[model samples]
Target chain A: MTIASEPADGYAVRSRILNFLKYGANSNPADPRVPFYRHPIFVRVAHWTNVIVLTVMLMSGLQIFNAHSALYWGYQSDFNHPLLSMVAMQNDDGSLKGVTQIGPWQFDTTGWLGASQVNGQWAVRGFPAWATIPGPQWLALGRLWHFFFAWLFVANGAIFASLAVYRGHFRRDLKPKVSDITGLPAEIAHHAKLQFPKGEAAKTYNGIQRLTYFTVIFIIGPLIVLTGLTMSPTLDSAFPFLPWLFGGRQSARTIHFLCAFSFVLFFIVHIVMVVLSGTWNNVRAMITGTYEIEQAGGRHG
Target chain B: MADGATRRGFLMRSFAGVATLALAGCDSISQQPWLDPLLRSAEALTMRVQRLFAGNHALAQEFTKADIAPMFRANGTLDPGTQEYRAHAQKNFADWRITVSGLVEHPLSLSMDQLRKLPARTQITRHDCVEGWSCIGEWTGAPLAHILALAQPKDEARYAVFYCADPMSDSNGDGINDSDFYYESLDMVEATHPQTLLAYKLNGQDLDIAHGAPVRVRAERQLGYKQPKYVKDIVLVDSLDKISGGRGGYWEDQGYNWWGGI
Candidate 1:
């Protein structure tokens, strides 16, 4: 059951040789090995900052979106309703008194009502008393935080990207090899079988990891930034093309929501993968930049 | 050995501090009398800042023709399903005259053709709906200020009320009357805003029936609903006290803010 106390003769060497032959020639101890992480201190800081800022942005954005419970286009079509609605109180005159229950067509005192006349007169909904806290005021504050933090995010990303190219981090960590491209079926089979090395964590990412990281870096990051900018009226004036790139303000909003959803998905998968591979060890390496490797058969080599 | 404990204590203290700040922020969630004043002041301050910034700058980005969406869905009461509206529509809107009256020194009932002949300003702007959809289209129309100039609004005029053709008697108390046409009012400030216009054309064509044909008001800075369509009359008033629900717009009277600037 253990590597030690078994034998110190030809049997031990024969077992080691057998293990190497079974796994691969690359699994041999004498083979050249990749470092656990090639990420620099700045890169690490940027990554963590991005994580925090993005999380805050998403949470704050949700709060703002909740302000307008219903959405519509053109004039005022009620094709879709908010996910939740509360029953509204009504007066003897058939006027809404307040919200009594929460359901579709229920009166959400907080929701935006379009232009509609009541009792032969125009009436609009008042901002709900409960919404006063994270109301327009809070939204404005959040906007300030989002915009200021965005600068840091952009700077960090720009630095990381330039450094990644200049320092060959992209080439070493993300570049797909010719074999990875040509042997796509084998690569997929390896993933499908979950045949990655057991004890030793992948030094560089596997093919799927590389692709996901690349897409997040090149595609999702730019999208989040561009869509966020498109929402800015001031920014739109400076760069008219930005709004056009994402359709319009409304379309940009849809894209922004979709991107946030994608980021959430990625975060869940990343956390799950870390736990699956080796939770404590992976976390410790990320924090302390070092990890103790267990030798084959559960002994420190 | 002590250093590790000290570091852990520091980390714990920092985390506790952050938690305290977060909790303090969350404490505002509960409604309080004082919080309302604070929020009001904050909103006012934000509006002031936004207004100042916007005034100093040119209008928000205007897009080219290629950027326009192939299809823009008409929002709100597509057809103001009213007998009066249907009658006007049947007449090809020749009988439809926009009455510019009330406090105006010179009241006028201008036909669609007359209104179209007035000097017009065309701008490609985004229409942001509170419901969370947006569309950009080229709108061409006469500045509302220009119309007010022609009508010669009296010195007491404080608001411009849009009277729509849709009626409100049929809804059976859903707060939204199927027979009621949408109506909105703007303070003299927004009414006279340079960008505010009585739009009759969209994307270089006469407004379609679904899009409040004949004429509509475009309060460009505000949300889409403020842009009252199928406008029948523009009534200048000194006070909104007597207006429907005294909130300014139909939706405003229902509980929405009259000034829905982004």
Candidate 2:
């Protein structure tokens, strides 16, 4: 059906679908004569590498954080109960089960009904049981993975940053021109109103995207890495400056948790934006490195 | 030159390629079981190299009494709920003798009084726990090296294992309980380090029961768990292979690292 004949909602949905199939909802395809992928092969490699590394780092980090049953604010005396606790155990039927602990200082194993008792023995109930794997558990292996992958994460990030600066990616894609920065008040208002002048979407990134992405790449990423290093006693000894830089080991740990929480927040917003804009188009560009664009009164495939 | 790639381009692409491979390996949540052996080997190699690097330099840091925290929380069993420990405590731990045996030239069971009389080193240092807690405390005790000298470790002895009076039983019966009184072993290098001591006093006062009174081994380089409390004997050994789970400590057997150096 033609765009003119479609219902308003239907038109929105179709546009979304088409957008998803073309550039991820927000990304603009390069001009016809320009290369299909805006990022060079090295940049793409570095970007995906970071994505994978960061995911593993976060998951393994959660596992390590789960090791301590209690988390404190100032000192051991100031320990606060975990926000959520899971009672981990194996069932008679050879399945795993978890009993969630909620509320203040109370452990509830009430939801553990489905699990069968093995050899007439009820499953062990505690925090570690929930997260720790039984018998030659890979805690050490997880640690090694976390440490080794951390190096790659940092190295890849460094390379990406260096290349960005060297290749003018920041200048071209991120940095606002003199007018854009000077007229930020109007630009911000325009964004808040969800209004984009014609041709503006393709040539310029919104202030919010620039600020968020820049913070993730420059501020949050480095903070996560630095705070993580401070948690290591070996590293702390070798680099005395770390503990001082982060207030102390515990403070560093707190910062690390904060940074990780911020990343999770960023991730949620990023996925929502993807879905809101056009999921398929974004996913396709990320995977295949090409996107079709819709020009004024015409379509360019 | 032949590929028409500049040196910078070649280096950049090579790094990116390796990073991609590493990232690919990290992508999957579940790794192949085969990765375990490789990781263990890498960890071992890293540990050995780290040990070598640290050998030439001083390891544990020394602090002042002012730096010592006002209170240090005791981890693990506060009191060994054993009749022997109770009886010993009733006698004021005066009769408690620490036996130095195994691969030693001179095996001796020395009384607490006798241990106190030996040459000692006092230092204020921080005890960091793996659970993300830390406390600084002043400890006065006989240097482990001095005690090892009195016991005269045999040339073959590689590790000094501290056996404690506390018997840790698995009351929960998960088939994991052995002796609850914690045991830890250290390589001879660390065992003989000048700073390594068998602490008898805390904060200028005799140690309290909850704080491993009578005697404890303070391997200050490691986290709090590595410091075995209520130490009653020292057993020198050639290897740790036959120890429980072959890792080196009560917690080490149950998932903690053997070399828990801070």
Candidate 3:
């Protein structure tokens, strides 16, 4: 039942090339179309909700980070020895420079980190104004934006995870198989050549995609949430073990920052992959839950 | 391969354009009337959840002396700087007095000497600032519960507000020292918590002017902003509705969430 088994008439490779060339606004193949229901209605809703929630959370989180502009690694800040810090350093005689320090190393990150132009004048800030929520150095509003979205993010994640587990989506789609691990090198080669699974193979996520989603969902996602909770004073009082697990609150802050940036990195790669693979098809799948595969849904190995 | 790469570049640029537009749309709607309260709902949720879990009695982590920072940052106002405050500081705060009034059964004015004689508690704890930094130091003072006991807050009292000497803004056009001063408040539950203190000493010494001299609050389970400094009075009230700007604290009035737990 595999595509190769029915190679004679399952899919016309000639029509596939022509269809890709046509590349209409709607990526619905005209004839011999395999409308694969890749994403369910629930998944589509959760995915889009997260798209908004995570964006607001990241932007507002940056605003909050700009307030302190330094990262320490203990119960309290040493002030002298920070893991990382963004500060406005003044050159001899005049002018301000944004210097970002990572341990012993320092970089002049002017117009961006540490010092940046705010309202047309040079100002000291951790991240640039464009990157933060509310577009100003307003800690109060930044906090409001952050905490508000944080609630949505957590609730959405909780609901998504519960449903994912209950409906066996985690097991059926996200979980990797022994063949996936064994085919790692070959899959890497194929992906390196910008070749994606086509025809029947496009029914589910590839091994690398499955692994990435799994790590992000189960590992990084929970770590970020836990580190965030550790920063709360009242929560610290209730769950003393939170700080202990993270080494300390300051360490948690550093890790939280790192995890945030990790999400950014993941997002970049995700977008690139989507664009490179098939922008309209991938987007349409997420949006409308109907993904047009190369061939008819015969049988997936 | 060249054609595919070219198409990818275009798609990437298009995605970036869409993302930028979305962000701009969000920024524009941030201050809209319809959405402001919706955003504030999280603050209430966080306060309710944290209070539910921690409750009133749970003590913030009490660290050993070794955990204390070498030099605790004296955040917020360094000194009140008003002529009256200057005179009080010059006199070693000997004549300075803190009044307890508002919803209290007995309004009383007590001097620093009398406050020092009240039931005292000392602990080394971390001070978490709203700006994402922390410092640890030892604080010695009368437990706020004992102070409330002496004042005998009335039955309707719900909040204990700490009024400080630090002037936050120049409200008066005359522009001298007549301005709304720094203030903070805690729920009666937090006020009665054993760790909540009207601290007057840091690291076994009288507090320096930079560190809210004469007196300050140590609401151990809350962020630094919840603990006002340079104390002058304690007002017990049933509601925070009538306070300056009416949001509970100075920062709270400035759009910071009233709940300082997180």
Candidate 4:
């Protein structure tokens, strides 16, 4: 079925724009009333838990990455080809020069991603001190933080995923149907204009929402976890094929970094959407399992 | 009981265990009588999982000389400056002997010259340090497999512990000195690995003092800390529990993972 493509009726569009600008429009002249159970208790709990676990994992991961500020592809790093590197190259002079490089492009990332002074001494510490946990160049502590949070993240993900599957929450809600795929172009158009579904349409996730949720949960999460295991030398011996599957240990490390940044991207978009859409209502749905919708004819359901 | 109830119970118990461990802190919780068994079990689980994934004979990747780090900074204690080590170093280690004993049917003391005469294998491999830096270097030495074959470890032998002459202790406010010895151990699988070498030469030159002179055991598949330098003796054992700190290596004794494969 073709989406109207004529843009959501002007009244709905106008209300959405006003609501967005107002930071969540609850007072629609045409009050559409619907109290939908947007998020279940299990989903809400998992979401919040993941918020903490992922944040710690990301920061601690950066700490561990700082130990070796270079990334490459293949079983071993040749040092000749680095997919990404954040480090300071010593100049002819006594001073340290910070550089962040990807492929052939080099950027001076001093005091930020590459090198920065901590405790008034020059160090080759990568990713800067502020970005890492413990805020020092301690690999042991970094590993501890990373492994601890990693276990938590994996356990939480496993439980949430299994429940999501068994409960059909994924199928009934997040899954995109044939119509969603067909209507994607129109949906993209609406999204480009910062337009969101309202009333009945808001009850269900939009096409882009379903896709993003599915990708983050299924694709991004598993990729990071598996690639992480691939980098372990012990695991490499046990699962010798893991390195081959990912091209090599360094390749796995690079993929893990990329996957992490992908989550960061998802988080930014998620926050933006949460703020743009009715922040109060969206937050309420997550916390109390209740969502207020703007239905047509100023009616409340 | 319903599946949901069982799942809830499991989740709650897991969370409670995590909370207890966290509150106790790794050091204190490890000292706790009850948690010791649990933590050891967790460590065992990690080792088992890695062993299951990694093949016993799987060789670590070999690299070309071009991949070697321009400046491979010496890690850990660079100088094993014991009076005995200095005496041997003065004579170019001609008097040094590496004793292969314990749990072995044939105990042999091989000198540097004898070791040089043995069949040698040279491979360029990357050394992955637990501290996160890595360096590739060409190591030429007699295969550890051949040495173990000559020693003929008894049936009960399960581990090969390499004792180094490095004085790792910084006791009495002095810098790293040879008051304490450095040592590392490897399981039978690692000990007998084809790539495992008693490396005496690096980059076509004799091993320097900064590197482990006389001899260094290269357990290629493990982290650099597992590669002990200044080889003074090799003791085969049925178990590592009786060793100092009972964790397998000096670093492992200091709370590093026993399995330093990563």
Candidate 5:
């Protein structure tokens, strides 16, 4: 909610903070741009917390994955017939080389995937040192980081979902309407041409944005959590149907890995869109809960 | 135009620099004293949550004969290379005795034959390693509960600490790992599990050195590390503080979560 009767100094301080962040000259004081309330306080907090939690979960997860450095399907790991594996082999000259095998096909991926430089020495590892949490071959610390943040991540997601539903944030912003489906083609066309919505339409997300957010939050979120739980032995004993639902334990692990990469993919696209659309406007909205809705210019379709 | 390109290059370089700086900061922060306990608190949460749901009586999944892997991969210390272990192995573990003492009324020093004569349990169960691999094998051994019942653990007995024959290298001189023998512990719930056994056989055959021959523990619900190989002693202790590293297990001493269910 906007405090319409706010003191003059509040806007001045916010403006000063923005000026320090921005490199270019300040916007004209004579013609002030009206601010539109976009993200709520809850959304802002949840969003920022996720940025930290997700990063730790991903990096530490890679460290954990490095322990086995292989993926399989079905109940147990078929060591000989792994779906994917990272192995180190000695060459003819006695030089160690890293090879990644994916179901009969093998590729030399030294210095990155299968093996990488660690502490100025060529070490056999799945992911590079830079990618993992501890920057070393420490499974224990990695696990600690993962499990700790995993709880936080789940808690954040639960809170965000409950709040979104309770506050009508879902219905008002995220939930797709009949028009969202009907206008999908036009939205896709606009996105393809790098033409974001302008004027009244720019006040809220387009059909594409709504659909993507909906899928990521509702569908992908639950799927990842379920798949993660399926890997636990005690959980499997407690809920036998979990692994059964995902085919098996190993299959669940494979799906969990896929879901992690899906988030990465979404993150890449999300960042590109934020940068392309209006970096300052979007970032400032998340930070201060208000957006400067752009006007229809000559470039607007 | 040149200025725009230069500025773009500088921005990209600075981004990479920032990322490196952030990673370095993360690494340093991970070593902080407060952060470790903060992260480890999740271990307690996970253990409590899992145990609450899966009760003590719940059994780990059992497999059929077909599910057993052709070769159950042997990991960690495959051999207890000490002279005592070598001599014991030479006689097919005839001289080998499992000393079950501490926090018990009837302390036991049972030979292999005596342990074999006790209540035996055979089941095909999956051995899940902490490194993320699983192998199904039919294990035959004396149920730990049957032995615990005979020994009659004292009221203060809170954990069944396992002492193995395998000696680990104590390189770091961390007094906790100085008693280099690989060891693990289980709570009363896990210790008393029907499937928990002092496994003396794998696939209907006597345990070989490669597989913790003489005996190894088979705590089916826990990860492989929790099931220490090369059994030598079984000590019942109330608190883990007096033991090596005081974390309960050798790997736990190395900063692993003591709760291995996950």
Candidate 6:
């Protein structure tokens, strides 16, 4: 239901103002007697499982990236041209110098990104020591960690998708209607002002959140998985069109890296929003499947 | 917001719980003895999914001559330094024989020249190493299926194990009389794959010593390690469990997966 459908009650309006002032935490509510059953039990389980799966996948993926540290736009790479590379050249004085080159643009990324000191010795590595699984330059073990969690990630993702479709989670929650777009500008402005919807408005996701979740789940999620599979040598032949579809294997690799960063960006924003909105309330809703909605009278239910 | 004390307590406790779980995953304790089976189960799922994608007869991507790398690296074993391998190299492998035995109607011992006379196939394909490097090379060799036909593998033959001459690990620093010899195996589908070959030629020339001369396996669907170099024998077996280290290949015994697809 649209936010306009609400009764236009004085308590709801006052509650919205109070929520805007306090940064969306359930406080100073006028109608605080209603509790919303928000998150489903299955969604809660899958969400937490994804926290672990994505952690392992991203870390190990960084480890895998360290092995080649170069991205290209074609099937083969010969060091002649690269779309991007994380590497450091050795100097005459035995010092390591790292650089990240994207096309003609080159940035000296010493002590980070491409090059770092591991155990007091300068080494050319992707990401950093803290960012890789096994925390070493072992590609073999990195692959093991990557493939292991990849299994879990894909399986969990399959479950999440099936449930989202079959159980109407998408329709009930994430799916956006035509009306969601009409309020986009106002929603963004309210977000920029740190003002949040309260009372019945807070019971369900806002338009921005609905759009974000839809994009992440349907668009980015599938693209990332498909691009990931495109990197496999066996799958290249089995599904020949995949490599060609993405332009080539290296192109798929570049897309995979960019998608990973997008995930990281989404994660950072998600956590920050969670904390700002109401850490305990959000976390509790995800855990116990119940959420307390605030109203204008400075009370919570 | 009025129940701030209780909410704060729950939040703090949940944060601590999640932190503990995450840290536990990062630590070595995650590799406890009890967890290996679970990990293997997950690995099995990965194998099944990969196999489902890679049908039995699908050929790996073949490249043109122009796409061939300038230097197709001979990794893992540059030279099988044993006296027997050296003797074979000195004589240009004139006396070298590859024995195809076990679970076959006829145990055939074919000389290097005899193998070259069989119906051969030439294809340029990418050699993807497990270490993440790749090189394209034009390989000319007898199709493994044609060679297997001469031996007539029995009904029970499910896997073909390729024996190599390389002594992978020798504590004495002397390659001779080493206990660790390199070997790799493939299931029936990969073994009989059209691209699967006992390659005797590389880049329009005779196989060099650095390469798996006399012959090395070319299982195009798998990683480079599965294509064992310095081949000396092919044994058809019902399972890989009875082999050395009971894994499938030397690298598999050393912690790589038995299935080397992708």
TM-score of predicted chain B versus true chain B for each candidate: 0.79, 0.82, 0.89, 0.85, 0.89, 0.89
lDDT of all predictions: 0.65, 0.67, 0.87, 0.80, 0.86, 0.82
Q: For residues A50-169, could you state the per-residue lDDT of candidate 5 as single tens digits?
A: 999999988999999999999999888888899999988888997668899988899999888887888898888998899999898999999999999999999999999999999989
What's the true lDDT of residue A99 in model 3?
97
Q: Sort by lDDT, best first: what order? A: 3, 5, 6, 4, 2, 1
Could you say which candidate leads in TM-score? Answer: 3
Docking class of 5: medium
Q: What share of the true interface contacts does each candidate keep?
A: 0.17, 0.15, 0.89, 0.31, 0.71, 0.47
Chain A alone, TM-score per model: 0.62, 0.68, 0.87, 0.87, 0.86, 0.86
Rate residue B227 of model 2 by lDDT: 84
The parts of candidate 2 lying over 4 Å away from their true place are A1-35, A69-152, A155-210, A291-301, B1-35, B38-42, B45-70, B99-109, B149-157, B171-181
Q: How well does candidate 2 score on lDDT at residue B92? A: 91
Give the TM-score comparing model 3 with the true structure, all chains together: 0.89
Tens-digit lDDT string for candidate 1 (A140-187):
344434444566667778988888888887898766676656766776
List model 6 lDDT by residue over A1-301, tens digit each.
1434667799767856655444454344344535678888889999999988898899888888898888777665556677788888887997888999989899999999789977687788978877887576876666777887887888898899899888888887789978889989999998877676777787778999999988887788888888888877778879989988987777787888898888899999998788667676778788999887766444443
Which scores better on DockQ, 2 or 6?
A: 6
Question: What is the overall TM-score of model 1 with all chains considered together?
Answer: 0.52
Each predicted complex: what DockQ? 0.13, 0.19, 0.71, 0.24, 0.60, 0.44
- B93-157: candidate 2 lDDT, tens digit per residue: 97899998999999989899998999988988767787656666889999988888988999999
- Candidate 4 chain A — worst ten consecutive residues by lDDT sum? A21-30
| Candidate 5, B221-262: lDDT as tens digits | 898999999888999999999899999999999998889899
Off by over 4 Å in 3: A1-33, A177-182, A295-301, B1-25, B171-178
What lDDT does model 1 reach?
0.65
Per-residue CA lDDT of model 4 for A44-137, tens digit only, reads 9999999888976887788788877888776666667777888787878877888999989999877777768875777788777666765677
The model with the greater TM-score, 5 or 6, is 5
TM-score of each: 0.52, 0.72, 0.89, 0.78, 0.88, 0.84
| B1-262: candidate 3 lDDT, tens digit per residue | 9999999999999999998877675567876887778888888789999999998888899999999999999888887888889999999999989899999888989899999999889999999999999999999999989888988998999999889999977666675555789888999999999999989999999999998889999998899999999989999999999998898999998888889998
**What tier of docking accuracy does candidate 4 attain?**
acceptable
* For model 1 chain A, the run of ten residues with the poorest summed lDDT: A70-79
Residue B63 C-alpha lDDT in model 6: 84
